[model samples]
Target chain A: MVLGGLIGLAGCALFPLLWMLSVSLMPPGAADTLPPPLLPQHPTLANYRVLFAQDGMGRYVFNSLLVASVTTLVSLGLNLGAGYAFAKLHFVGRERLFQLLVGALVLPAQVTMMPLFLLLKWMGLVNTYVGVMAPMLVTVFGIFIVRQYARSLPDELLEAARIDGAGEGWIFLRVVVPLIKPIMVTLAVFTFLASWNDFMWPLIILTGQEHYTLPVALAALSREHAQDTGTMMAGALVTTLPVLVLFLVLQRHYIQGLLLGSVKG
Target chain B: MRPQRLTGWLFAGPALAVMTVFFFIPVLGGLALSLTDFDPYALADWHNLRFVGLGNYLVLLERPAFWSALGNTLYFVVAGVPLTMGLALAAALLLNHRLARWQGAFRTALFAPVVTTVVAAAVVWRYLFNTRAGMINVALQAVGLQPVDWLGNPRWAMPTLILFAAWKNFGYDMVLFLAGLQAIDPFLYEAARLDGASAPRRFWHITLPMLAPTTLIVGLLTVAGYFQLFAEPYVITEGGPLQSTVSVLYLMYDDGFKWWHLGMASAIAFLLFALIYAVSFMLLRLARKRGAA
Candidate 1:
């Protein structure tokens, strides 16, 4: 009975994703046929081919990859430096400053949408990749994560390095950077997936089709082609598959980071 | 700890500066903007901006669209939260069973949706829930049920979004619950079994109490997350079928970005922030009191 229950539970959890895969492979109009077929009678890559060639989805895919990767690299640099400082270095008003940053998290990102849009527009950043990447360039959550992980590093190591007359920059690069590689990788993965999956800000900022991220592109596609189930499924598959793969590979760190953020907050 | 003050400042300076310039400034500006009649005209020329004080808020309170948005948001939270938590708890319990095999694979598969881009997944769900050619209706027909227009009907639209929300989110809570369940002592279950407790009884008495903290956190997170319903409604329903899915954020999006009613949009944003703050505070307090009791 217990085994049967477990099997049923697993089945329930996996059904949608499995169904998505099955339906994506089905020939046009097959999936929505009466008594929806579990397996495609005629599998075809026509949907995917059309998505790539006719729909210009491949461009959007490249845009998503570019935006997500750039955001990750840039933010990682900013967060790592700042996180290390908060954790290891002594600074003026450090506790109070950190508290203020944490407090800002309560102010939902949406609160800033109106003004930030105007701000970006004024800066001529709107509809540019930089515009999509700007607000996400340095996140408080990323700083907090890096700080939390950095705090565990031994003070003696840094102290010893400093004693050897190494400058702050040198210490950061030669000592700190190499030491925190794991957390850095973890933070990089976290930032990349988030930027990749982000829909709202990108949707708002990237008004032009040329700059549209996958989520925004997919959303537009869904709106325009509501009847084209197979094609939309193909779009969804394209948008989702990359991040899904990343999560599957780095789930441990992702879950750990999630819990850290949640519990700490 | 030497030169700690300067070093800390140096470390935190870049992030703090970025956040302050981009995040803090805009939020404060948002509040200030809410007090003004900042419209599309203001977007073009600063002279067109008029200081309206509480006029925007007053107007919003009397607006039918605002009320509808609030009602839709409430419907989403009230209906979506419990359904998500319940499903998550059920999944967690099933995974916690000793007889469960292939647990890792099952967990990953379940969580796959959570990691998927919301807009993308929402797109897929839109197709799946489509009226004529949707696989959902086809399956319903096979099961001897009449096909319901999932997204087109005002009555069924919000519920469909709620169902989608539950499916998309429950896996997250399931993981949290699984962690919480693993932390529970097995000896308590053994004790319950020895005392002639049935599985359900054991679950009710021992499982629930020990899992209280987890449940509280999950509930709080779910409520907060659900309150910010935008992308799902945007992609799946477009807050459509008689505006049944018009969430507060969606309303703000429409007002601020689409219509260029910057001042009114800012007001809606602040109002949402206030509501979320109040609700989460009350929830945390209630949880603490329950724990004390």
Candidate 2:
């Protein structure tokens, strides 16, 4: 009984996605059916082909890939340095500043959106890739995660490095970077997935179709081609397949980071 | 430890600088922006700007759209949070059950939606809930039930969104509940079983209490997350079908970007922040009273 119930819930969770996959592969008019066939009668890649070649979806996919990857790499660098300093380095106003940051987390990111848009406009970045990528290049949560992990690193190693004539930059690159490699990977994945999935800010910023990320493009497609279920599903599939694959491959780091975040900051 | 002020500043400078210039200053600027009549004219040329003080906030209170947006947002929170939490608790309990097999697979399947791109998933959901040729309508016909326009009808729109939001989010909370369930001692259940307590009785008395802290945290997180509903409505309904699914954040996006009403949009943003902050504070206080860590 328990097993049956569990499977039922899991099936419900997965049914929509499975159905989407089935319909995406179906011939053009196949999904408009009586019983809604469980499997495509003749599976074809025509929808995907049309999406990439005709609809210019490949550009959106490339945009999403570029933005997410750049945001992840840059965020990893910024957060690692700041978080390590908060954890291991002693400085004036360290505790106070960290406390201020933790408090600021309560203020929703929306509070900054309107003015940040103006700020980006003044810097002549509005409607550009740089505008969409600017504010997200460093995240408070990323810094917090790195700081939480970095606190566990022993100071003795850093002191010994200093005694060996290693500067702060050299020690960070050689010592700290290797030690916190796991969290760095985790943070990278987190930032990448988030930027890929992000909608609102990108929607607000990217005014032109040429600059639209995959999510923004999919949203536009859904509105314009509301009748084209097959193509919409294909678009959705391409957009989601990458992150889903990454999650499956690095399942441990993702879930570990999730639990660690929930249990701690 | 000796203070390394110079090195610490050097290490933290770039991030702190970015945060200050982009995040902190803009947050303060949003508040300042809210106090002015910074419309599209102001955007075009700086000569149109005017310090309106509380006029924007006052104007929002008078506006019917703002109230409707707030109502829709509250409806989502009041409706969506409990539904999602209930599903999460049930799923967590089922996965934690002693008889459950292939637990990891089940957990992964259930949690997959949380990781998927929202816009992509929302597209799939839009297809499934389509009015005419939708799979849902076909299934309804199979069951001899009438079809309803899930997204096109204003009444059903929010509820359909609530259902989709719950499905997308419950897995995340389920994981949290699973962690809480694991932390509970088996000996407690052993004791209850020995004391002639029925399974339901044990669950009601023991499981619920043991899960209270997790429940509080989950509830807070869910409420906070749900109150900011935008993308689902944007992609699915476009806040359409008579503006039924217009959330506060959605309204802010429309006002700030679509219409270029920066002052009014900033006001809406701060109002939302205040509401979330207040509710979070209350939840934290309640958790403290319950000795929740």
Candidate 3:
């Protein structure tokens, strides 16, 4: 009985998302009825048609994909280097600098939005993809996660590589990179998911509708088409499905990253 | 070993530069901006700016909008955090059960929401709670209850958003609690069972105390997260049904981005930062004291 109840609760957890998919396939206005339809009686893709062909959701999808990909790739490289450095390399004030970065984590990102916007505006980056992707290019958490994982690298192995006459850059590229592959995958998945789902910063920085990412564009669409439930669900599905699938595919690494960053850190 | 100082700097410099220029500098600038009347006119011409020296903050203290937003945010954090944590704990406990079937699938199902875009999830939830046509109301009426104006009613709007937030967010803490649960030694529970302790007794004495550290971490994370309630109200109710759902971040967005009141918005941001920092600091202190005791 207990197990059955728990299973039902898990079903409840997935119900809204499943319902969203169901409603998105419904013909417009079919969902707005008493004793509301559980599944579309006549499933159609007209709402999606409207979204892509007319509402220009395709552009937003492209924008989201472009921004998230850039963020993941660039951030992975920068965070990997810095994180590995903090973990193994000897330097003056290395601990102090890492501590400073950790302290900065306590300050909320929202506190910087006003001035950051102004600064971006000064540099003519506001409403551009670069503006949308700038602040996230190197996150403190990313660095922290990478540092935590990189610390587990065997010091003897690094010393062996160094004694064999491998230069620091070559050692990082050939040795450390290969060793930290698991954390790298974890960080990539984490970064991509976060960058894809990020709304507030993109919403703030990208003012032009043409420049808008999926979430921002979806928000704008919802405000304009509050009554158009089918189209709205279609938008939601498009915005969420990629990350959902990505999470499902990379579940282990994603969960590992979560526990590593929170519990152990 | 040689001090690879230059190599280390070379590796770290780019990231440090990004953080310093983008994050740190802007934070310092935000403080300076908060002290001055930085508005649209100031944006247009530098000479239009005037040093206000706490004038914006003084005005915010008297503004009804600021107070209402603060109250709404506090309400969200207080109610939403407990609901999210309770549901998370319950789900984690259930998933942690020895008899639980397909634990991986169930865990993934429970955690799916954490990955979805908040604006998208909020949009989906807004439709689900529609008064006349929504599944929730349909189920309510099926159960012989009156349909609620979930978004349209002033009193109901916040509660609806709370429910939406808990559903969307509980998975995150569930994962945390699961980790916490697994970390506990099973021998304690075995001993409790051997000693004639009932399930409830075991839970109260063994489980709750053992989960205290995890509870503190989860509590701090949830509180800090819930305090920044914006996207749900922004997408679901537009902070509406008479501004009943206006959050501090929403207010900051309106003041800073919408109305171009950069100074006032910076003050709001700083206030929110200070509030979150204070609360988190307190939680950490409280947790340390408990640990010491």
Candidate 4:
């Protein structure tokens, strides 16, 4: 029964993806015909070629990569620093401050989006990548994950470094970072995937076609070319394939990072 | 002061500064903006801004679109959350069964939708759900079932969105529940079996109790997350078929960006915040009534 249910349910979950693959390969106007083709009669690379060369998908891809990577690098540093401090450092109002920060999680991101946009406009960052990336550079959830994982790091390691005449900066760079590298990787994957897939921020902030990330670009394209199924499907495949491949390859870390911050954390 | 005591600030200062400037400030600023009569004109000229305390909220309450958005969001939450949870629980149980094979493959397939780009997925589904030439309609015709216009008809639009949401989300919850299920003591099940209890009874008394906390967390998260529905409809239907799919967040997005009514949009945002906050607390209260998480 589990096997039966498994195939049936998983089939339902994956059917659209398969359909997308099939239709994307179909000849132009094929999917629009009666009893739309289940499989492409003659598969071709024409749509993908058109997307990359003519439609300027290469630019969107580059923009997504640049934004996601930069966000990941910056967030990894900031979140790790703050999380390590909360976990291992002794400070006045430490617990209270951590609690205050954690409490901010309940306020959804949408609540601040409008004002954030206005703020960006004032700062002359509007329509720039910086504007799109600023709001998500560090998340409360990201900090929580680092803090939770870092709490388990043995105190003796930090204390030993301190006893050896190492300063706080040296201790963090030499000891804390290496010890918590796994969590850093998890956070990196999480941030990178999120930044890559994020639509609304880029859609709102990226005013010009030249600046649009893949997801935002695809959304705009879909609206304009709703009649062109093959072209849109090709666009969808390009938008989805990177993250899908990343998840497939590093699914262990991706799923682990998610579960660490969420279910048990 | 001890060096460690001061280093906390040194380490935490950057993150604190970023969050304060980007997140905390905007939250407070959104509240202030909600109290005013700011719009595109105000964006262009600061002098046009007027302090109209509660006026935006009042306007929102009077707007037919706002009520429709709230109703649509409520329908989604009431319908989508339960269906997603139900499917997740069922799938988790099936995968958790000792008799199940190739569980990992099944798990990955089910969870694939969660990571896929929403816009991309919506593109795929929009085609599959096309009014006349959709593959879904073709399949229905093959099966001798009537083909309904999934996204073009107001009655079916929201439901189709709900279905897409559940399909996309249930796997993440299923993974959570599977984790919860694994943590349950097998000895309890053994004891129940020895006592001649049926599988249904074991599930009712043991499985349900063991999963209460997981269920609570998942429920609260799902409810809160579902309230912010924007991407799917924005991508697939564009809140069309006469606006049946316009969620609260979608409405906020339209008002805020499309019309540049930051004041009204901020009010809608706060109202959404209040709603999700209340719903979260209520879910927690409901969970605690049966048992603690």
Regions of candidate 1 where Cα sits further than 4 Å from its true position:
A28-37, B1-4
Q: lDDT tens digits, residues A171-203, model 4?
A: 999888998888888888899889998988788
lDDT, candidate 4, B1-293, per-residue tens = 58778899999889989999999999999999999999999999999999999999998889999999999999999999999999999999999999899988999999999999888999888888888988888888899999998998999999999999999899889988998899999999999999999999999999999888888888888888899999998989999889999999999998999999999999999999999999888778887787756
Docking quality level of the chain pair in candidate 4: high
Query: Which candidate number would show the highest DockQ if scored against the true structure?
Result: 4
- Please, what are the lDDT tens digits per residue for candidate 2 over residues A36-117? 6768989999889889988899899889999999988888999999999999888889899999888787788888999999
lDDT of 4: 0.89
Q: Sort by DockQ, best first: what order?
A: 4, 3, 2, 1
What tens digits encode model 3's per-residue C-alpha lDDT throughout A48-151?
Answer: 99899989999999999999999999999999989998998888999999899988878888989999999999999999999999989898888998898889
How many clashes show up per model?
A: 6, 0, 0, 0
TM-score winner between 1 and 4, please give it: 4
Clashing residue pairs, backbone N/CA/C < 3 A, model 4: none
* Two-chain complex of model 3, DockQ on C-alpha atoms against the true structure: 0.80
* lDDT string, candidate 3, B1-293, tens digits: 45588888889989999988899999999999999999999989989999999999999999999999999999999999999999999999999988788889889999998998998999999888988788898898889999899999999999999999899999999999999899999999999999999999998998889999888888988898999988899899999989999999999999999999999999999999999999988888888888821
Better structure of 1 and 3 per lDDT: 3
| Whole-model Cα lDDT of every candidate shown, in order | 0.86, 0.89, 0.91, 0.89
By summed lDDT, the worst window of 10 consecutive residues in model 3 chain B runs over B284-293
